[model samples]
Target: MTHLPRRDIIALGLMTFALFIGAGNIIFPPIIAQQAGEQIWLAAAGFLITAVGLPVITIMALSRMQGSIENISRPLGHVTSLLFTVVCYLSVGPLFATPRTATISYEIGFSSYFGTSSSHLFIYSALYFFVVAWVSLYPNKLLDSVGHILAPLKIVLLAILGLSAVIVPRELFAPAIGHYIDHPVSEGFISGYLTMDTLGALVFGIVIVQAIQSRGVSDPKLITKYAVIASLISGVGLTLLYVSLFKLGMLSHDIAPNAVNGAVILHAYVQHVFGNLGGLLLSSLIFLACMVTAIGLTCSCAEYFSQLTKISYKLLVIVLIIFSFLISNLGLTKLITVSVPVLSTIYPPSIVIIILSFFWTFWNKPQHVVIPVTIVAFIFGVIDGFKVAGFSKLLPDFIQHLPLSEQNLAWLIPSFSALIICIIIDRYND
Candidate 1:
């Protein structure tokens, strides 16, 4: 295996961290922690498991596969690969995640400051996307430039927020009713999955791999080694930040009621520590961080499609920006609620595939192992999405009255069954 130079390795690690730490990272954990209260650390641990550990696994899988997103799914055959790639790409980019960047940016950066008029919100968001489109029109070293600048700023703002919670002395309140109900750890574990940062890491892993290849590191084994190390560094940074945010959130419970939103908790914490000026200053930093992330996602999606379709990247960027700007007017609460079902359906299959691919060599023919299993898993996952979104009522009454409807665990049941069947089939075939 060829060794990457130490400096290059460090740079790659920083870049990986930049890719993972976006607006969601800053917003979600605190909300979970505040809600979870006494269970904050448990939830943070669960989140780190998926948010950090799974992402590292994704990079390692990509490195081992030594291919594009399409190639990674090639073990499922050409048609399956095509379908999976299209779904995965669309999930990450234009269809789901890309629009989320704009919506999140508006919620965190502008909503607090802007008036309640939908027209004004749309106008400001349009301007926001216009700037994103302009910056992305010509791909430059701007990703690197902006990443370098904002990465530090993000860290500084986070540190300030964390320190404020530590030094200012706030009391913690009782956990919310559903917060620690049933199994707190399991709830936290599952809620951690909702951060969606792991999925981001998986998508961004391709970018890191390409960056490595661009630097002329062609050996698959060497790429895997560097990617793992880089992902670990990034993961550690993410874990630390999450823990701090969780703590800060839990500490904020005494200051406000349980119904306070995450942004409100954050704003209060900042004001408590730094006063009004400090709150505004932190808000400004968050706005820039969110904008930079939005720009990066827009540029990445536009460039990828441009390469594939020979469409003008500039035009695509403009279209995506305009659409996302319109979408951003939906407001944060609605966006989060609307996105959950879709994510529930899409993310599970991708994660399962990433996990299964690691054991690909164990199968007699990898395609035989991957294709049927993924298809079955996805079918179940889609059913789960429908149930979660309250669409199960659309089914015939008798069908809806089945045992499955009572449990409300559509994917869990079929997915486990599929896994068992796959294992049996693989073992007998081998």
Candidate 2:
């Protein structure tokens, strides 16, 4: 059994880190910190739980299963397996996360110059995805293209931005507002969902496995071990990155108190300290950050679909990238609006499956425990999606009263209840 050399392992870790730390991840921490103000620590910690913690757990779990998300769902049933796989791939791939990368890069790199709604948005997005498709056309070079070149460039640019923040500063401290004043942790945990890291993890796991296997690490245990280490490396790198951004956000309120969102917070700070040149530098960093992630996701999605169908991965990349290009025309805000309900519906069940996959080995007749709870979670998740879209009048008031419903955690109580009941049924059946 051959082990990957130290350099290969480190390269893989860096590549994994780079894959996870996309432009969207770069935006959230500062904005959250800007809101949390002096309480940024607690809020950021809570945010890290889902953002960093879940993604790490997700990767680790995937590594244990040799990186096949389909394997994790194999116990559920064929229809369930295929349905979840397709939904997970489509939702995170072309339909939502993938296109948003192009839109966001356009927003950061070109929006100010061209205006977000300018005729140039389409042109910019077309160029962006074109590059994404090109880079992703050769999946085998991912370790070098992403791990060595892109990751290092992104980290250097971010380090410069972070160091500059330390030297120039925004303001000493910003005050906590709204929910951050009281339930900083809870709100932060909830807000972490917006990062979408958890959802991305399920899809990314397979990609990580492929990358590892490409490195000549054929042992399953070694693959799992290396993957877990890489996820930790990714988590640690993101945490450091987020801390720097959050620190900047804590100081930024005095300079740009009117900042509405993360992108605004980021742009305001970079432009303030660096000026026009700084803004341009920031634009490059944003583009590189988004581009690498788009490449990884495109490759992963194409790989999955290619396996599912008789189509080749290369052809699938072209098809998916073109489809993603079309979706990019929908614009970022519209894409986000559509994604929220879809995410709300799917995320609950996705989280449940992750938990079940982690613990199902200890259960007797694990299918009894997995299927019923997943079905219940799925049903409730859809209803919750309707509620989020102003169709709440269709749901019973009782559901609205579920514990933590006010915090949008309404699925917790019922899901847990279903899990317990299913376990009992499994035991009875046994």
Question: TM-score for each prediction?
Answer: 0.86, 0.95
What tens digits encode model 2's per-residue C-alpha lDDT throughout 213-303? Answer: 8877789999899999899888888888877888878767876785788888888888888887878887988898888788888998999
The parts of candidate 2 lying over 4 Å away from their true place are: 166-171
The clash numbers for all candidates, in the given order, read: 0, 1
Q: Candidate 2: minimum summed lDDT over ten consecutive residues — where? A: 165-174
List per-prediction Cα lDDT, in the order shown.
0.68, 0.84
Tens digit of lDDT per residue, candidate 1, span 1-430?
Answer: 3566776676677667766666776777777777776666676777778777887778777777653566667787788777776666666665666667666665666666775677766777777677767766755544354435555566676677766666656657566557454455656666666667656655565666765665678888888788888778878777777777777787777665574567777767677667768657666666656665665566666666676789997888887777677667776667767777877777777777888877877777777777777776677667667776888777667645644444333445556677667777888987
- CA-RMSD of model 2: 1.8
* Each prediction's RMSD to truth: 3.4, 1.8
Give the Å error, residue 382, model 2.
Answer: 1.7
